[model samples]
Target: MKTSTRLEQAIKKLYVAFHNNTLHPECCKQCAVGNILNNTDSWKHLSDYHGALELNYIGKVNESFGRKFNGYSPSELLKIEATFLKACGYQLPLHYKNSKPKHPTNKDVLFNGLTKVVTFLCELDGVSNVMDYTKLFEFINEKPRFQLDDVITF
Candidate 1:
């Protein structure tokens, strides 16, 4: 599937961050947006609060100036962060004591966050969700590869 060059780059970065255990929802420099921006915390200035979708004064100025970090506008970046936080079970506007996963580096948790971020990015770019595998389930010869309830004998 064809994807924008920038989105492709962003996905690669996020994938690496997830596998390298560098992705963290709490840290601005290691969060989804940060990873997409080359692990820079500067994207935090785009919003007054972490996980917020509203752009602050600085963010508005940057948006007005048509500035993009790794090809994402200020608003897009904010949305991406918000999506990641939500997927990771974070309360909006992240707090030190807020309810979070017991192990942030847990692969399952990170994968959930990555899936959400990738979905949002795909939507933003008007492309199909890269993480979606539903198409792979489409029937061939009017039969699925396997039944959902099928038991495996190993």
Candidate 2:
């Protein structure tokens, strides 16, 4: 599939996850994205547009929770993130910096999936401004729950 096509599919998958509550909306907040990016170099190339979209989605989640940001441990957040990635038919890149690694088909799948999702989010919604990472993390910490049966389709 083309890069753009992959991105579209990824975004759709994320949307489905959000709708189904499989991926916590707060996970995409500005703070959360920043945290993930800071912790992992994988997202360094993410454009401002994509960041904004994520922030917006995170803000929406915060609104729903009546909070600004929810906090969670790095390991806990990783688990949630991994679940979303898996739902989107992708895996977590082994290393943050080497998002687009050469080896391993699984890594390629994840890199492609994340790239598509980020691009779609940047273009489709203005997320950067709406996101608050701190609030997002707090929300996650408050309620760390996932419904395994809740399937997210693209």
Candidate 3:
């Protein structure tokens, strides 16, 4: 398949996972695109439009964060982390305790922080609807390497 088609299929898979309430960490992975065909629950059916929207939104958000701040301050990082969590259809936690600092490099620390944020986002609920893919793409394209394909399927 073409890359565009592959991306579309990936997006569709995400939507299906979302609608079935299977997009959580237990059912899917942090990489939403990879989760599409990762053989999680099972490739039961094509994702509906609603599922696609949710998937696309999450993808856009992830791409946005990756582009905007390759490195970020701790506090700014926390907000970005929160945005990622929300994009994954998760609600922000009532209280967020800071993790201990161990990594020496900014990249290492950012990776560790993102891992925790992704984990927290995966635990959220009540995400069972489609969003506007156009808006998602627009927001994501504000940063580089974050463009949605013109067409999608599967």
Candidate 4:
């Protein structure tokens, strides 16, 4: 089984989180990416010029793959975060509480987000659909130093 890259697993996790609607803090009433979409006050707390929020989904993705801001360069991490958000249909540089992108239709939101995830996955790494959470867990849990290269293509 070829191991998935850090980028691949992160994209997958973000997709799953978005799918499950558990990607954000409970108090925010929005997923992590949702914060960026709304450009609410929460977005600023998640990431500034200093560092990515260790408690947010983006940070969790970074931590899951043993990545460390790729050396504390928060801007780079934010770029990755912004890319993911953009893939989900949100524009960048969330500057205000009312900053918003063209809101996706209810049905299209998931589609857009997933599409972005797939594109990012493909471009950042060579991973594809890579679905199946149970298998991912098995792979990650079975090995002490499991490489996240085993992926399922849709």
Q: In what order do the candidates fall by lDDT, top score first? A: 1, 4, 2, 3
List RMSD in Å for every model shown: 6.0, 16.9, 17.7, 11.2
**Candidate achieving the largest TM-score:** 1
Error of 3 at 61 (Å): 25
Please give the lDDT score for candidate 4.
Answer: 0.45
Please provide, for model 1 over 78-149, each residue's C-alpha lDDT reduced to its tens digit, 9 standing for 90 to 100.
999999988988888888877877887788888999999999998999987877666557677888865543
Off-target runs (Cα >4 Å) in candidate 3 are 1-3, 25-34, 37-154
Each candidate structure's TM-score, on Cα atoms with residue i matched to residue i, is 0.88, 0.23, 0.27, 0.43
Model 2 TM-score relative to the real fold = 0.23
1 or 4, which is superior by lDDT?
1
On lDDT, the leading prediction is 1
lDDT of 2 by residue, 1-154 (tens): 1223433443455445434434321234322233333323233222223222232444445445654112322333343344434434433442344243233234344444345445434443333312123333333556834332222222
Report the lDDT tens digits of candidate 4 across residue range 20-117. 66553222224433333332333334454221323456545555676543132333344545554555555444434423445533436655655654
Put down candidate 3 lDDT per residue, 32-145, tens digits, no spaces.
322444543221111212122222343445445663222222223334334433443443331224222332123433334334443332322222112324433444335634
Ranking the candidates on TM-score from highest down gives 1, 4, 3, 2
